[model samples]
Target: MRWFIFIAIYILVDIYAFQAIRTLTKNPWIYSIYVFLSLAVLAALIYQVSTLGAGKVLDIKSMYVFGIFLTVFVPKLLIVVFMFGEDIARFFVGIFMKVAGSDEAQFMASRRKFVSTIALGIAAIPFASLLYGMIQGKYNYKVLKYSLEFDDLPEEFDGFTLTQLSDVHSGSFDNREKVEYAVNLINEQQSDVILFTGDLVNNLAEEMDDWKQLFSSLKAPNGVFSILGNHDYGDYVKWDSAAAQAENLRKLKNIQNEMGWNLLLNENRFIEKNGQKIAVVGVENWGLNGFKQAGDINKACEGISNSDFKILLSHDPSHWQAQVKDSPRNFQLTLSGHTHGMQFGIEIPGIIKWSPIKYRYKNWAGIYEEFGRYINVNRGFGFLGYPGRIGIWPEITVIKLKRKKPQT
Candidate 1:
């Protein structure tokens, strides 16, 4: 709903901006016609994308319109992309330069154009890379990864290995070869346990049948444990009857079992080896917003003692943010996915990694530790929209947990 409004306004603003640029240029009439027609072409194409089933024709039309924008619209866009950055930089630098030292003020004043260019380029670069990645399969991979390291741990269980995969969205995958490769990657890890945090299929459990045999190939020394992601509930699919949704969820549960995973739903189990015990707990999706269902964390932790080392698998990182981070149960680690880093991001020194998702989960990816608790959010193993990833690669994380040795 918000997206629809944004696109509508974006097209409108694009038309107005292009027309205003045309008024400033040579052959104004010609440019105006081109701008108006390009926008119309774009609008019609976007409408079809919303209503039509995805296929070759729609794809071809989309590329055609995009190519038109990239080529023809570049001029109009640059007309401002070139101008807007300078204006903003100058406005900001001028105000700051007075209070700032002479050299400092001049330096800021000098970099306005650079800053502006960089600001515009930041957005333009990722979006353009996303489009180009579609052609090269540069952003397409069936893996998600994050590493876990524990400090001040038990010597025996410290460096315990766990691998996490999440949001596979098997429905979004088309490359069987890639699926096999992902499975092989998981199997290759010298892991004691493998955890899949959820979204094994998009919305249809049937989507997993073709890939189930492939996924069944993954093995760890201990076992694979999984919990439901939001998509696994089958809410995104249209149902002829409520029974169909129920049936799909049933199939999803069975699919998890068939894949040889311990499906932990608001439950707990203990992994004991060599005189050490670690509790593994999982809960159904209890996101922060409308998606938040009633997943009882206390119930999941019921039988487990607080002194035992514990790991948790919850779907949304936000759930950890809301509940798990400060819970009294003493879970040492929590694994989650569902952010996918927008399946797009910017990378350099400190990446500006954000999707609309950041507004939801501040610790959307990598490692987040606060107040003696930790969470690792996987970027995701599958593509969602535009069928690709850019900057953020799919991950296959191997985390090592080590116990602190006794002081001499």
Candidate 2:
């Protein structure tokens, strides 16, 4: 029933768009060519969806789905907007003709080629952007650096540097060379600790099988620590049985351990330098509303004092806004990455930083501070869904801890 509704709407839009194309190019051969190409694109999209079915995971095949949809949908949307506007103008004109007792004047009006040409021109922008996003934007990883000052930070860790990454989404990766390059870039930062805030795989643990070695290559003197994201629990896909799903999660944990990552599940570990220690706590997926809420900050912070300088690794920024900020124990800093800036947005340093997801999640990207505490949301390390990124390129964040100077 849903498919029927979708096809019905899609056909209507296609027909309306084709009519505008016909007006722009009156040649029968050109019209026939456009019709054939449109049908072929639609067929390819339908065939891909049907073939992938319920077991669809992010891969090269998924890219085809996004590509075909953008190719057909963007142009149709532009054409429809122009057609609707022209119809409104024609409606007012018709009313004038009727009032003037010149109803026959309607026969003289025809679809304007300039309007159709303008629609086509406007539609090309997104078409080109999407194409570039798929080809180059996804691999465009940017290393962003931040220097944060804390009044209560441990003096031993004053110059401490930490590298943070999130939303690897290993299942979506198709280019090993590109990923290898990203890993190399990470090593170049040479931070004291490397923290991966989650979405290691899209749905299954097996997704990491191919890239395990590459990711295991990531090194930091203080060690690499990780936490599970909402997608890590195999919750999004149907499992054969409850036991199977549990086993998949166990394997994912084991894989992280094998790669030398301390998979912190509502747990805390201490990082020490020159005998001075700071707490690093991690929690499972804890998103608001529709997402899973498995994180327990109190449980993770057990045995740690409120005055201790602490850093948190949580997958979703909402967790910080909801629970971490007001906790009895003040976490000095929190690192997160679930939002991914919707993998599309414009961020120009201090000038402007905006993404559609900002309306939903206040701390969508970069560093956000409130009530003396801070959260740095990494703009994901990989792409998902759209198989590309537009303006919000993949990010690698490096944060340096600085001690605040006291006023004399």
Candidate 3:
């Protein structure tokens, strides 16, 4: 039923977009090529969707299928928008002509060739962008830096720097060289500590089998701390038995340990410098709307005090608003990643930062502060669902903690 609605929408968009193409060209060859390509994508989509089963995870092939579908569909949807607008204008124009008793007036006016041409020209931008995103933009890593001021931050840890990465959906990666480059980029920051807010794989633990050694090289002075994201739980894939699923999660934890990451499961650790300490509290995956709620913040905060400067690692940003921000516990900074900014959006610093995900999750990406507490939603270190990233490229966040000066 889901695929039915999706394909139905795709066909409608194609038909409307084809009308625009027809207006611009009388050439049979162009029309034949266009129809052929459209049918090819539709057939591929059908084949992929039909073969998917309950236990099947979203693999690389499915990712490309989705990516190709988006590459073709989004531009055509744009064309439909322009053509629909033109049709509406023609509708009203025809009414005005008939009202005036014009001799040659029809129920609707013909589409202008220039308008169709313009629509296609405009649609080409996203078409090209989607292609680029699949080929290169998926691996285009960006290092985002921020210096946060905290009045209660301990003086000894004033210049503390931490690099945060999240949502490493290893199952979707096809290019090893690109992944290596991103790893190198993370190391280049040389932050004091590395914090990974999870989703190490799409589903299976073996997904990281090939890339384990490469990622194990990531180093930081204060050590690498990590907490599970929803995907890491292997809930998306079906297992033969409960034992198998438990074993899969066990293996994933072992893998993270092999990579020198401290797998904090509703646990807390302190990063101390000189004589001052700040709590690094981690919880399991906890998200809103039926997502896994394995995270226990109160349990993780055990033995910690409200006066201590605390950094909370919970994979989903929704946890911040739901519990951390308003809790009696003063969690100064929360790091998370799950929305992935929908893996597509327009973001120009200080100008516009927009993604469809924002409507679903308010703190979907980047930094947000409430009542002096902060959360930095890493734009994700990897891609999932869609094989590529559009405007919202993969992110590596570098956050520096500075103690705010007291004023006279």
Candidate 4:
């Protein structure tokens, strides 16, 4: 909806600017008139945006949804495939006429219809997928079973289970009812600890209230912990004042608190159970730049012993580059959720296929072990711009650490 409004505004501005420039070559009055008209349109758009929001104008957000779908979606394909599905049937009709005989000329006459129908159907799949994604688009939740093993064992911490879920961008969730279902799904895991890797919301920090009720229902046997994701800082949206943005962050943090989560910002906490000790470290939204950089491993790991079984929660899988591999730290496991697989792709039997998001991210999902360090990226519990999960589902990571035999 916002995209449509933005496009409409851009079209208006383009018209006015083009007319204004053309008129400048003739007379001052003509140029002034066009310029004034452009400003008037912009003013009107601003006023309307203030009153009803972009959502008011989008009665049927499907037709011109290309502006929102193009990033990872294609709609023209939908129109040709679904709308003009007759061609597909006629193509088969011609094939039957040519092969089985009877009415070759008649078949030829209607073959294009079949072809058109098929093309439209083929196109309709992704578009409908996008449309359905807009409507019933949901988060994929999978319990990625992996372990980080070290030579030493924390006596009481062995066999501890941590339920990990990440990238629950509440802002992109348009279905309030579905979100409640998701909450129920997460609660069903019932792990000893719940850790959220990041990306709690898509754009605005104020979106916290939207899912407050749903989040309030989440409870674990031990406790819930969270770290800031890139989106949590509210960088994508424009605010009238920086203070407003700051206050928004504060509100987001408060929401986390209300949800019974401990926001571990570049800090560590000890989990002592059965006389065994383990450290849980959390960092801010730090990544490889052009993203957030609030994660401070140094601060998070400060005063930690070398041998502690440290579980670090960093939003980005890229953060493993900075803290896990070569850093002089003992972070046994790091949890991240910057990538939700863009809610596309496949996870089939022996054939993990689909989606181009893999081209951008090496360890986008599942457990990735590099240089003896480990990181797990969650598929996420919410949708983004296109708003659907075709195959690469959202996840609920059930991580159970294990012991590894020493290399003799």
How would you encode candidate 4's per-residue C-alpha lDDT over 49-69 as one tens digit per residue? 465453222212321243243
Sort by lDDT, best first: 3, 2, 1, 4
Q: Rank the candidates by TM-score, best first.
A: 3, 2, 1, 4
Report the number of clashing residue pairs per model: 16, 0, 0, 31
The C-alpha local distance difference test score for the whole of candidate 2 amounts to 0.88
Question: lDDT of candidate 4?
Answer: 0.69
TM-score of each: 0.75, 0.94, 0.95, 0.73
Off by over 4 Å in 4: 1-118, 139-150, 405-408
Summarize candidate 3's per-residue lDDT along 86-147 as a digit string, tens digits: 88888787788779987533334234566788999999999999999899888999999999
Worst 10 residues of 2 by lDDT: 103-112
Pick by TM-score: which candidate is best? 3
Candidate 3 has its poorest 10 consecutive residues by lDDT at 103-112
Q: Which candidate number maximizes lDDT?
A: 3
Give the lDDT of residue 116 in candidate 1.
Answer: 42
- Model 3 stretches astray by more than 4 angstroms: 1-9, 98-111
Shift in Å, residue 296, candidate 1? 1.7
Give the alpha carbon lDDT tens digit for every residue of 1-408 in model 2.
Answer: 877887788888888888677776669998888778777877777777787678455466766576668856887888888877977877887788788888544353444566777888898887887888888899999999999999999899988999999999998888899999999999999999999999999889999999999999999999999999999999977777899899999999999999999999999999987899999999999999799999998899998999999999999999998888877799999999999899878878779998999999989999989889999999999877888888999999999999998989
